[model samples]
Target: MRDARPAALGVRPAALGVATATTILLAGCSAPVQLPDPPVDDATRALCTALVADAPATLLGSPRRATTGSLAVAWGDPPITLACGLPQPAGLTPTSQCLEVNGVGWWSQDGVTGTVFTTVGRAAYVQVGVPNSYGNTGDALAELASVVADHDTLLRPCVG
Candidate 1:
């Protein structure tokens, strides 16, 4: 008597098991991200590249994610992102509250998305965008300030 199994379904049971296992293994894998590149001039671009390259491996106990194009980095699942070579904040004024972290001066503002801190009095403006989930923007800025100061020249110190 001829076998009743369909010829099209001839795949070995072992092969099917292997394929299922492979799929299960890959299900939890996450692809690395590339953030939107902000506009930057030649001078600023150079500084940005240097800053990204020198950024620490971890910030606030979150591992750094791979990034490309202009200067950008992210950490943690919610992802605290930092972008360099951005335009200076137009709203910034002499009276704008400035905070010094790790010897770098930053103008901090809370936005709907999160708290944004921009380097003040630096050769190139750098912005750090911390999601509201992070909760501690000060620590993030403190960890990042050294990297910013390494790449950009400080024009003036934070006043008041």
Candidate 2:
């Protein structure tokens, strides 16, 4: 992503040159993508609970938010990107998928069949999908189970 600064900010030519060079220089560095704060909702909250229960340490113990019909979870560490085939629109091979617990899409376009986890704000996202390999459903199931565990935290305990 390119950072577009205003050209009419009274920036002198020398300053603009410096800014442009600085931008280029910064772009060379691998900077983690930033996402907006996530919103809390019933569904997302439930999901969070399940995730925590499944694997408390897997998640960086950060608050999460709901966004665009999905729960967003961010991480305290640098987000990870992988080729996870998340459900997408039919016939549209998504360039990539991004997951952030705090309601932010954090996936990037890469030609691999793996899952990518991302973090936005204080939350993180763990994505699951079908892999290009065979007979690995057990692994997938285990991953899903871990994610489902967080749901326990997302939802209020049933009155019993």
Candidate 3:
């Protein structure tokens, strides 16, 4: 019986090998990272788009992942995700601990899963969901402060 491989079908063996290798390489390189798309109003959506465009390529020292069609960004394998235009945090109070970093205010609330930090007093709320493993929420918030400030209007400042 004659050979019945790709070469026997008038295709070069080297070309077939290269094509298979290229396919595998492209597949490995093009994996998409999934992230949550927080719902927002039209005004907030516009602000979120601006924030996303200004977001840094890295967060907490990890390379920013390519998020799948969301007004959000992530870093690391199980990423530290930041979703903009979230509804105002229900837990915020007059006395809630707020920190100012690079002229932006953040209200932080700790939960079992992780620490949630929201930009306080901004016209549109931007939330950063930092996992417990991250250890330093401050750095992530600091990195994001300018982007949030540039895109959203401050309604009030963090009080002492």
Best by TM-score: 1
Per-residue lDDT, model 1, residue 7, is 10
How would you encode candidate 2's per-residue C-alpha lDDT over 1-160 as one tens digit per residue? 1211111111214545564344334323533222222344555455554553344243223222212122322222222111111222222223333243232333322213323222212232334222223233234334344344333222221111
Task: Please write out the lDDT profile of model 3 over residues 1-160, one tens digit for every residue.
Answer: 2211111112223545564344334334644434335567888888888888889998878888766646777666445667776666666766777899888988876645467777877897777767677887788888888888889899999874
Alpha-carbon runs more than 4 Å astray in model 3: 1-34
- Which ranking of candidates, highest TM-score first? 1, 3, 2
- State each candidate's clash count: 0, 34, 0
Model 1 sits at a Cα RMSD from the real structure of: 17.0
How does model 1 fare in lDDT? 0.67
lDDT comparing candidate 3 with the true structure: 0.67
Tell me the deviation in Å of residue 121 in model 3: 0.5
